[model samples]
Target: MFNTIEHINKENRNWLKSFYFIHKLSFRTLWARKASWVGTFIFSCCLLILFPFGLGTEALQRADIQIGTFWIMNEFVAVLTISRIFSAEQECNGMDLILTSKLQKTSIIAGKISFTAFQIFTLQIPILLLWIIFYNINSNILVNLLNNLFFVSIFFNLGSASLGTLITCLTARSLAKEILLPMLFFPLQSGILLASVSLTIHIGNNSLLGAFSESAWWTILIAYPIIFSTLGILLSDLLLQE
Candidate 1:
């Protein structure tokens, strides 16, 4: 019994160390390549600026339009960039290095998801600020706007992040991954995308915190992240194996 307990504790310690190592590595990898995503963010800003033309300046001046535009840009950017999370590893054969090492597969997946989710959030920040400026969002709406943005990013990102990992691992070695990723990812994303959009629309109508609690948004927000993140986490080992 003592030996079993000792073995379990050692395994836990090694797992925790591997987790932190991979997490730190994810940050380092993205930071070194930060310009790639930052450029994407700038591109999004330009796209949002042009949006007033098609959406109509007056129509986009509405609070709902502003909020919707922010998340819609996020959804678009995520779809475009999600493949890169693992593509880097595959491109350089980093996966083989990892595979031969003692690192846990789930830890690597968690790190990728963490980095992707955080990247998605970073991508939204500039667009969201531009959103507020363009819409002339009042001080009264600021708190609720930020609140919903924060939570919705979390919920929306959970699903996207997981989907990002699942697709990356599944397609890491594929010759057609660039073409295949969006096809695979967007379908998994549609339900969460639709849910978050509905939730955003409800929030746009303004009932503050009460609006979230009163509608199906809360359930949809809570359920999707849990379901998708779990699926990604549980299947990661199988997905990453040689």
Candidate 2:
């Protein structure tokens, strides 16, 4: 039991060190171009605001459109936000420094993921607040909406981050990243949007317990991120080699 406890402690220490190193790298990357990051945040906020107007009053009344618009906005932002992670590093010539550092590749990747997740979370804040302010949703509905947003954010962000990392690893240069990232991301984004939107609409129109009772759709939304994140980590070294 003592030996097991010591081994667990050592593993925990290693994990914490990895997380700290990655967090620093992630913050530095975001800080390096505060202006661009701010711009992206504002742009995403505007896009989210446009949803109500863009969907029109008729669509807003329709549970399907309302839910669909929310997910579409979320998926769009997530995919775009993550697709740029590594490409940005390469553009600034920071990849070379990162590659040569003593940090483990896993830590570097974790840092990138952490940084991307922060950006995504920051971007979501304005949208969520705006959504709650503008919509006539009730407190219970709002809570449900917020819950859906949280889950969708986690699912889409993790999947996109992993996919972005893989793409960055494969391309090694910025131009290819610009061209290829969207192509690879959009289909997955569409699928996620479809599942989330459909589920949200169903939940919004039905009882909470009833919605939760529904199977398969929720499972898919929750499962995609896990599968993709694992795939991304597993493939990172192989893709990064070139």
Best by TM-score: 1
lDDT of 2 by residue, 163-209 (tens): 66665666655566667777766775555555566666765876322
Computed on alpha carbons, the lDDT of every model, listed in order, comes to 0.74, 0.65
Worst 10 residues of 2 by lDDT: 207-216
Error of 1 at 31 (Å): 1.3
Extract clashing residue pairs from model 1.
none
Query: Which one wins on lDDT?
Result: 1
TM-score per candidate, in order?
Answer: 0.88, 0.80
Off by over 4 Å in 1: 206-215
Runs in model 2 lying further than 4 Å from the true structure? 1-15, 138-140, 207-213
Writing each residue's lDDT as its tens digit, candidate 1 over 7-89 gives 99998888778778766766666567776587778778877778889898888767677777777788777875675676566
In model 2, what are the clashing residue pairs, if there are any? none
Candidate 2, residue 225: the lDDT equals: 65
